[model samples]
Target: MLSRLAAPILGIPRPAKRVIVLAVDASLCVLTVWLAYYLRLGEWVKISGEGFWQPQWAVAGSLALALPIFIVNGFYRAIFRYSGLAALMTIIKAVAVYGLLYASIFTAVGLEGVPRTIGLIQPMLLLLTVGASRMLARFWLGGVYQNQLRMATLPRVLIYGAGNAGRQLAAAMANSHEMRVVGFMDDDDRLHGHVLNGLPIYSPADLPSLVSSLHIATVLLAIPSASRYRRNEMIQQMRRAHVEVRTLPSVSELAQGTVSTSDLRELDIDDLLGREPVNPNLLLLGKAIHGKVVLVTGAGGSIGSELCRQILAVGPVELVLVEQSEFALYEIHQELLGRVGEAPVILHPVLASVRDRHLMQDIMRRYRPDTVYHAAAYKHVPLVEHNPVEGIRNNTLGTLVAAEAAAAAGVADFVLISTDKAVRPTNIMGASKRLAEMTLQALSAAGSQTRYSMVRFGNVLGSSGSVVPKFRRQIQDGGPITLTHPEITRYFMTIPEAAQLVIQAGAMAKGGDVFVLDMGSPVKIRDLAVQMIELSGLCLKSPANPDGDIEIRITGLRPGEKLYEELLIGNNPSPTSHPRIMKAHEEFLPWPQLRARLDALETALDATDLDVVEALLTDLVAGFRCESDTPGWNGTATALAANHA
Candidate 1:
């Protein structure tokens, strides 16, 4: 009934609200003065009492002092419901000043009928009444007293650390209506069983029991300084408990601000696969590109775009982006332009295929770049296996065109972005990449001004056609997570880290050097799927637990897919200046002999001779295994041959 009555008052105009509060304060002042007299005289007092210094005089004087002081101190201007400590302090200060002035005029001046004690007693009574009124208003108007009921409906969470970040995050979330922080779980034994800011600090070992007892739906990780391995362990523990987990970004990313609920992010999948990235060697990274014109082919691709971003940060004089797709080119170019901000670097966005020899030659000649990064290729294994001819034409033939153009244009350094699939090839894509590597090696061996090298690494997370994004989408859609094989494993890294390492590797390259990034231990496909499901607050739907949320489905392996990938074909990789980069000593064909075979392959490709193309690719690329009966290869080839005729 009181809340319904207060609702209309809350809806009143600001000016009317102020008038109402001012009138309330006027009445409070008069009542406090009478109460003071009644307390002093030990009897009821009336405002109509006689004399020049009567009770009526005291009421009028009190109002004159109190109302103006309250108004000037912003007492009437404050919104009562949202008022806090600062507002209360303003009240105390204003009342103290009013009390001092009232005492001087009424009591300290030695008035005959006024008692000096009433002056002191009246302000003290008024202070209590004024402060209590605001509190009561906040409770009634803001409905803050109902927070207990609201909190019960909010999702309960436990912070996974008790340090400064955890405390700050808890404080920031205190008013949040979405999630209620019930307690903290820390690894520290000393903090266990203790109370922090009225919340219990339980040991991490009790997470399973705590999740059940407290009904915790999520765990927020606040240990930003924790290593990747340590974080992965904690995440696994939460997963086993069947609670969802989110985390704060790295300490460096959190440097500029206090920990807040908005800063929480989903667990990074990359942390599950790799170790802490080593800081890039600034000198090595800036060696080839600083103050020099640079160009990157496939410039809008995952690795290619990242290379452009890092290269721009390295302060290149000019950055030319060569991409085949018009939309991809426009997107990356616009993004780079936003980051350029006052930097003198000139950006050139060119829409042209790397396979076009004349176009590539023209771009390279026009830029005469100091360094060229070749990242364009058809990388999806199954897709390339189905379209073998186009995959070979783009991956193998395109590298030859780009590298030769760079050399002919007198570009100083050329870097080809290779993959682990190129090491021991079973698929058309892998064979084509290996042949591209040979093209660069042969070019370097034939003695050109351009120094050609290749950087080979494993799968980059979040790339198009990568399992990471596919898994994320499946999880979001409440699905059956699909994998090619239960036993299959693959190496993974972040795109930015891969690009940074690629640049450093290219900078340290000598002629024909094949630099391989040291990808941490490969992660199994089944384990990855399970971890993803668990971290998403879900469980595997299997016979063992039929009530689980999502099922992990194993599809048969696709054509050209491998159970695992290798970074190097040969053994004994030598360490480079950077700890993460390794140089491999591998054999290659000389240019004269390789060129004749390449010419024959080109002729065979133009003639639509699928059988001859397969023979030449298998003969040219080491460890090449041709799947003659790969599902769609024969049908596509037949269609192409008939169309050509």
Candidate 2:
């Protein structure tokens, strides 16, 4: 109740607050001077002898001189409730100067009928009293002590670094009532057992004991400069302790030299993956987009949208977003415009599917984009497997239309976003993307000015088809977190990293280059689920722990889903200029042969016979294997052969 009342007084207007502080200091000056006289002169300073104001001239002069000195030294400018050591030091300096000046004047005037010793005694008394009063206000009001008052409710947190970045973070959270910082965890042996900001610095090995004793529930990673691999190692240790973990923004992301509430957020899964990104090659990144007209197909999709962002950052002359969905198109277009506000890039949003050949050609002729990043495709595996004809029509035929149009328009660069599933595929989505890659390869082989290239990587971490989000949603809904298979594993990369490598890889293209990204390592689906649940401070339900918060349920793999995904069709990839990308020399059908097969594919697709399309894909795409040899598919294959015959 008392703290609540004090809050309003502390929150008063600046000028008013200063006036109140000034008045209090002036009264304290008179009181300290009178006390000084009473202490030094026994009978003369008695109330009956001089009425405590006998030295009326001295008390009046003290106020007249000391108030101006205190005001001049910015004593009142330092808010009483928030003032610190700096303010205390300024008070001492002002009092010392006042004493010396007053003593000099009185010496020349022979004490001016006042006690000589009062001048020396008063300065010392004033310094002690005034300085102490300022600190008392800070303590009484909601300053650092406020954090102490709410320590019972606030979660005890431990900071994970003791370096410069860690210190800045500590300063920001000094008076925070939401989380009380218990101590710091550092790897440096020298810092162990030492106190930092009133909290002990513990070694990494001491975290378990400290967390247990201190009842710490959260750990904030303040090592902004730590490598991803090192940070992940620390997080794994934290997870073992069953504590929630978070992190500060990276050094580049933090405001020049400060940390704030906005700079702290939950640790990203990419950080846990421990893949330290290689710095992008700026020259290669901008080679295709800088000052050139750039067009992105499926520009509103996850990968496409990120490509637009990176392209805009590279100073493209004009950006054309070609998306089939109207809402997705408008959303991305608005987001891009807002991000690049007033920037000199001309943005054009075209709501036309890549399957529309005439529209694709018209866009090509209208903009004549120097670079076209083809990101359009039906990527959902089960959905594409169920509707193979439309999948191939949109993915394969769409790429054909866009590639042919770009070639005819003499576009300088044509880059197709391919997938790891496209390699030795079993699903229609993968096969469609493989066929798209083949189309780009064949277009380049046909001797066109457009330099066709494709960048192949595994599943992006948060794309529309990512299993991560599905598991997250299921977890949020509270129940069985479904896993397709216990052994299923796939490569993962953050959206930004994949987009960056794509632009760099595309720019390095000599001709039809199949650039494969170095998708660090494959992560098992089961392990990923377990890690996510644990890091969220939740336990998984199993035979051993039947009362866990989240339950993991396994469902049989869907059609066209594989236990593992491969990034290369063959193992003969040569390294590119960039460390994390490679160029693969895969065999592609010549335009003459591929063109005839495509024509037959169109005829088969138009017939609406699923079996004929499957047979065509199996025969045309090398290394393509059927996920199932069900008796039904065999019967359909025979029927398809009879009809073709």
Candidate 3:
């Protein structure tokens, strides 16, 4: 009803609005005068012996005073929708002015029968009526109009935080046509039963009941300042309640000082797990890759592709992608192409092997890439152990060729992607990677132009060969999920995050720097598998419970597998600006000695001398140890033969 009245007041064209404004002001003045008289006289009938209560005299005097005062104050001149602090001030001023005018009129006519006490009630009545009318127009009337226009039929939503962000979110949703707020759920007991924006705050424990009773289909998490662990816990709780969850982005993203619907996003898959924040050095990242022609070898592999993505964001002048696999190369190429858009940076996709010295040199010479991210080494442990000669040839010799090419081409920086297993090595793959790091240290000592470095970390989640994906597949296949050992554990990180840190570490490198990323505490594989199963809404199958959804079977450790991996080779690690990145200080053979060892090792690898290769690698890689007692030459002959052919 108020909305219908406000339409002509607001939308009846400009001239009509002005006319309605005058009428409303005049009507309000008349109402105030009549109210004052009625309160003073007690009835429409004249009060005997009270001259001031006489109808004609009282009515004429009230209008004569109130009308001029209302018009002069411009009390009805402002748009109600645009009314704010200014309008509020104007209302206060107009009421004060009318109060004085009414007092003066009563005084001039002589307060013969008019009681002075009746004048006191006039100001209070005027203030109440004027303030109430505007407040009604501001809140109640707009809502009514919006509802009449079908804007009130929104999905009822419950917010998860009842703090400042939640209250602001509720206000933002006031007129929203797609989402209506039911109330809030917070963990703070102090906030329980408190009302914010007319919505009650309930504890998280009440979520299920509240959701069911309110028919809530959506939940907005307004805890932008909450820690990741807390958010993860809330998400898990919400998921169990079968509520679809969304969240405002970090507080830093709220530039307008309020959370809008556009700022709310679907809960990311990463938020389901309690992942801690990583603080990387932006200066280091920019120093390493910005304005430089950066080359990423094996650019299509999981880690390598992520590296390419991060490097592109860091403002590299050119990104050279070198990979042997056509499909893998194409995938990364297409992805980068889409993200970089029409930026001036050149993207040179070269199909080549790091093992091809001439090809490596030619590409390096042609592009003169300032930084090279060598990530092409073969890394599967058991597969490499079974193909020792091929593994050594690629992982070791491939790194040597690439490093030498970088040196010859005078590249400013060369970063080798090394693995954690390279420390106290047990497998052929680990030994090969250790040898590659040795080769880089040797090359850096001998060269003047290139600064060689290696960034080493552990297993990344969802990478192609990581156990997480394998376990997922096994679970999906409705069978036993394979585990090497119940006690085995590995450090894990999301691939993109690891790669971003890798690039940032690269930017911090000096000559022969070995940067180790802080992979948080290692997780037991069996526990991880079980968590995945539970998260997938299934129970583990066991001998005791044959009818369970999935069975976890132990496959004894593989030939070259380790129960756990270490990050550093020595005790001395220097802290960097980034808390997660550290620089390792370890001994390296002098250039000439390292060069002679590499020469002999290459000859042994070429000749398929498995026994000699094993001995040479053990001698070269300090602290190296072999786990497998199998015969030394078990798989070398076939592997070498295949490589040569």
Candidate 4:
């Protein structure tokens, strides 16, 4: 019945609602004055039965003073249901001023038809009635009182901190109709068993029981300042309780210093990794980039774009972005332009493939870049496996062209962005990258003026075609998360950190140095998928929980996909000055020998000779084994060999 009544009131025109409230306040003002007169006289007072002072005049004077004061103080501008403590304070201030004016006229000075005490009594009564009315309207029209009727049906949640962020989050949720916060789960034992903001604080150890008793469907992590390792522990506990988890952004991201529902996000996969990133060596980071002309090939790609961004931050005099795709070049160019902001760095977007040696050399000579970061290559395993010829031409031969161009241009430092897949390769993409690394080593050994180096690491989270965004999209679509294999694992790093480390690694490079980043630990794909689902407030669908929110479908492994990736092919990697980087003492072919083989490979490529290409790739890249099951890859060498004969 209240909601039914409120529905029409809520639908009423704003002007009409304001008039109704004003009329009500006018009535309240008159009523309070009459009551003040009677209470001061200790009997029913007649307005007409007085000399100069009368109750009738008192009521008139009260309405005249209070109503306009309320209006001038912007009292009627407040919506009743939305009025909070600030609004009430406005009312008190307005009434206080009205009370002082009334006292000055009636008591401090002398009013012919007003009792002096009436001024004080009447304003006090008005404040009470006015404050009460606003409260009643908030309870009725705001549906806050009615919300209590169905509170049990709302989804219950527990905040995993008792800090200021958690308290602010609880307050923010108090106004939300979607979820209800029942308690806080803090690791601090002193905070346990205490009540905060009308919610109980419980130990994380009691989470299982609390979840059962309170029926918590979600757990929000409000400890933004907490370390990644601590957050991982809290999330593990939440997973054990079988509840969904969400987290606030890191302290650095929360510059606004406040928490709201909008600030809550799904638990990041990096949070699951629990690896603290090492601070980059400042000198190393700036040695090759600061005040120098820097060029990055494949600048539109994930790692390449990030490398461009970090290079820009290091105050490069000019940054040249070389990309095959026109759209990608425009995007990074525009983004860098936006970030330029008063900086004197000039941006050049060059749309050309790294395969075109003449074009690359022209661009290099024209720019005369101090450092060149070669990130242009085919890195996706399965895609490159299917299109092996193009993959090899791009990843392997492209490196050779870019390195020679940089050398001819007298580039100071040439960094090749290699990958962990290049170590003990099993796919065309890996084999191609290994060959690229070898090309750099060979070039460095051949004694160019350029200092050539390679930085190799594992998968970066959120790269295009990577599993992170794929899983997120699948979860949002509410369905089965696809997994290549349950047992497959890979190292993960944030793109920014990887790019920063790449720059530092390059800066520390001696000629022919192969720097491998310490990719913390391998994360199982199945476990990662499960964490993503749970963090998104979903349950994994399986035989154990048939009523779960999402199902995990194993599609087996893709062609040439490895069970696990490795960072180092050779044993005993030496540590660098930077903790997270290592220098691998890997062997490679001499420049003269490798040059002859490269020439033969190029000739075979130009002739489209599949047999010689495959034979040469296998012979060139050690530990490269082709999977027999890959379509279009099986028996290529035999067919080509027969055709040649």
Candidate 5:
């Protein structure tokens, strides 16, 4: 209670701080002269000489010379709250100015009998006394500020990175009575054993011992310039030591120059995965969709829905959502409506498919959407392998129809959502997507006004049917989570991140371009499943421990499955505005040649000739490959043929 009351007095706002500084300087001047006089004369000598007070004259002379010099240097203008390098420079100037003024006063008053050494000691004492008082004020006021707040019973924290950013954060939290900082943890060995402000720096390697000894509940990450992967690694290490985690925002967010406790946020669960950061091109993304009528097909699916959310921030005039699924479409439509309330953009959720060319044409003519993001397709490899005709129909023919409609409607851009599986595809699904890419490329070359492009990437984390969600569900069920093969690995990204990159790529596309997202190092399926289990605070059930919480089971690879996925079809991908997205320059068929292939594929589909359609699809898609048939594969092919017949 006492400390709380003392805070305001000690805080010393700008006006008060200046007054105190000037008072201290003036007072120090008088004290120095008196001390010099006593030391030189060897007694409390009276200054009166022939009924004139000489010592009084000397005291008055010192104040007159020193006070104006201190004021002129603007020493009082320094804000203690923002004091750092600049503050140090101001102090140096104040000392120099006062020293010169004091020397001049002694000469003018003819007090030349005073030892010259007294002049030297006076300036040193004045600088030390004044500077030391400022430091004391900071310490007292900081304590008072902390006591004012009603703090939570959180554990003491030690932040890593004790540079300018760290020091500022520490100062901001000085009055934070709730979470006390014991010291700083830094990688610089030189910084070890040095005290910053009042906190000591400890080596990062000693965190385990420090956390245990200090009983720290949390460790705040203040290294804003650290790479995302590095930050994740540090956070994981901290988590292993049984400490909770938090982080300061990126340096860019604090460019305006103040670091506040409000900007400190709890570490997100996603940071534990050690994912690399993505740098996006804001201008390129804004150029294509900002204030333009944009439509996303399959707008309810994982990729399509995320595209809608990201595009909303790009300031589209209208966002037309076209989807065949009623529930999925309704969910995204409701979400968007809630977020962009009363904005000029229209969020029209139309229940339609790209296969319905007549319906698509009508909507296109009605809306005249400036850009269309075509994400509608049959994506599951095993499912598409079983139902090849539907796969080819939706993916291959659907893309053809969408591209043609966009061309007829004079749309500005058309982006086909392609897959890494399309590169040297090992499944019918991949082969079909490759055919779709070819269709768009041919259309773009054949005098289409619209800029046609395909953005290819692999499985996104947390998407429907993705391994992460499936593993999560299996772990929840307290049993075995299945994996296709221990060796199977694929490129992964968050759904929103992938979708954002896709939109950015679409915005950068010219005619007949294929953009591949830079999905950093692929993760093995078994390892990913294991990490998910462990992160959920569960142990793996195995021969070593029968009572373990989760069991991982390996299922043989399904048909059309590959051990790994690739992003580019061939060599030499050109870079884009964003480092994470690359444009693949591949050869394409002429309009006439592609048209003939489509006719053949249609005939093969109508006749229920599985072999003919497979051959035609392979001939059209360069570097096409398929895994050997499995039990599910054979059964599905037979059923598909019977249905067509």
Candidate 6:
């Protein structure tokens, strides 16, 4: 019934509502001033008085002065529901101004028995009346936050902090119609059992009970300054209680260095990394990029894109982006342009394959880049194993072409982005990468001016076709997560960190240097999937939980997939200036001999002869053993021998 009566007022435009508030303030000014006179006289009503409630200029002037003063103080500009101490301060100022003006004007008019003390009492009365009026309206009429009250229909949530960020988040949630805040779950014993924002704050140990009692479906982590390990522990506890989880951005991403509703976001997969990222070495970051022309192949790929972003930030003179995919190239190019926003870095997006020798040389000569970051290659194990020919042609031959061009163009520094699988390869993809590294090693040995190096790290978290994103999508789709093997393990790093480490390693390189990055630890694929499922507030389909939301299924390993990945090619590793990067002393064939073998491999590949390709890979790659000599061809050994003959 109240809403029905207020419909007309609510239907008015927002600014028009402020006009209504202005008129209401004028009325209150007159009423409060009259009330002030009564208080000064110390009387309830003058029933038998000759001049009872006499008309006075002071009363008339009260409305005149208060209305303009309130407008000037911007009293009506605040959203009533969201108003706080700032709004109250504005009211105090307006009252003081109106009262002073009223006193001076009415006193000079000498208008009758208005005591001078009434002037002092009137302003204080005005402040109380105006402040109370807005509070009453906000509390009773549901001032713009009426929709927020509708949030009771949605899932109830408990915040996990009771400090400033948590309090602010609770208030902001009160303005959101998507979810409702039930209470706070904090770890501080001092804050336990206290009521904040009219909601109780409970200890973390009480979360399970509170969650059940309140039917809370979500737990928001408003502790932005918390370490990743602590956040993970909290999330694990909440998820174990079978409740969903959300979190705000880190402390640095908060608005004005404080939490805001806009800063609230869902938890990303990286939150599971369980520690802070390492601080990068600035001198190393600037060594290759600052004021130098840098060219990156595969500049549209995941690691490639991150390298481009970081390189652009470090004041590169010009950036040459070489990518084969049209859409991918266009996307990274447009992103760089928008992000750079007219920065002096010259962005050149080249649409050409790294395998094309002529195009590689042409661009290298045209740009005359000082540093070349070669990142192009086929990386997926299963896909590359199935299509070994294309994989070898791209990863192996592409590196040769890019390196040769860089050498011919006198590019001073060259960095090849490599992977851990290249160390002791079981798959065609890894073997191809190993050969690519050797190609660069050979080029560096040929007395080229370019200081060639390779940075080999383990799997990056969000790289294309990596397990993290694949798992995220499966979980989102109500999944039976497919794993290759129960015991498979791989090292993980963030994309930005991988790229930064690669740049740093390249900066510290001499000719033919193979730098192995310090990947933190090897995580079991099975364990990672289990942790992911648990963190998603879902139980695994095992003996304990017969009726679980998600299941992990073992799909036997692919043909070329390895049970473990290794970062080092050999035992010898020399320490570098940076702790996370190490220089490896590995042997490579001289360019004089490598060039001839490359020609033979190219010839064998062009003829579509898989037998020779397999033989060459087995003989040329160190520690590469062939499980079966099957060329995956229709012909038998006799036919293969005759064909080779």
Which candidate ranks first by TM-score, i.e. highest? Answer: 1
Error of 3 at 55 (Å): 64
Q: Would you list the clashing residue pairs of candidate 3?
A: 541-550
List per-prediction Cα lDDT, in the order shown. Answer: 0.88, 0.84, 0.78, 0.87, 0.79, 0.81
Decreasing lDDT order of the candidates: 1, 4, 2, 6, 5, 3
- Candidate 6 per-residue lDDT over residues 530-616, each given as its tens digit: 877776667788778889988888998887778889888688898988878888877778888888888889887777677788788
Worst 10 residues of 6 by lDDT: 46-55
Better candidate number, 4 or 6, judged by TM-score: 4
Q: Please report, as a residue range, the 10-residue window in candidate 2 with the lowest summed lDDT.
A: 43-52
TM-score of 1: 0.78
Per-residue CA lDDT of model 3 for 1-645, tens digit only, reads: 765675554445756766765666556655665676677768654523354454344445555666676667775555464346677777788778767766666654445555554455656676777677777677855655557456346778888888888888888887777888888888899989998778998888887787688887788999888877888888777655656678887776675666777777755444544767676677877887898899999998889998898899888899999999999999899988899887777788889999999999999999999899999988899889877877888998999899889889988888999999998888989989988898888777775578899999988877878876687788779858999899998877778778888887877777888999888778788976776565454577887878778889998999888898988889889998888889988788988998898889889877777777878877889877777744455443555555555
Between candidates 1 and 3, which one is better according to lDDT? 1
Return the lDDT, model 6, position 459: 86
Error of 1 at 420 (Å): 0.6
Backbone clashes in candidate 1 total 0
- Model 1, 392-416: lDDT tens digits are 8999999999999999899999999
Poorly placed runs, candidate 5 (over 4 Å): 1-227, 235-276, 541-549, 628-637, 643-645
Winner by lDDT: 1
Better of 3 and 4 by lDDT: 4
TM-score for model 6? 0.75
Better of 4 and 5 by lDDT: 4
Off by over 4 Å in 4: 1-154, 544-547, 637-645
Superpose all Cα atoms of candidate 2 onto the true structure and report the RMSD in Å to 1 decimal.
12.4
The whole-model C-alpha lDDT of candidate 5 against the native structure comes to: 0.79
Residues 1-645, candidate 5, lDDT per residue (tens digit)?
Answer: 755556566555768867877787788777766666677666564544324325655667667766776667665666354234565566667777777766665544456345454555666676766666666655656555444434434558888889877888898887675577778998899999999897999988888799778877677789988877888777656644656567888788778868878888755334545766676678877878999999999999999999999999888999999999999999999999988976777788999989888988888888999999999999988888777778889999988888888888989999999999999888889998988898888888898889999999998876778876677678768869988888998888888788889888988888899999988888787876666665454577889988877888888889889999999878899987788989898777998998997998989887767777767766777887656473224324565666655
What is the Å distance of residue 553 in model 3 from its true position? Answer: 1.7
Residue 141 local lDDT, model 4:
83
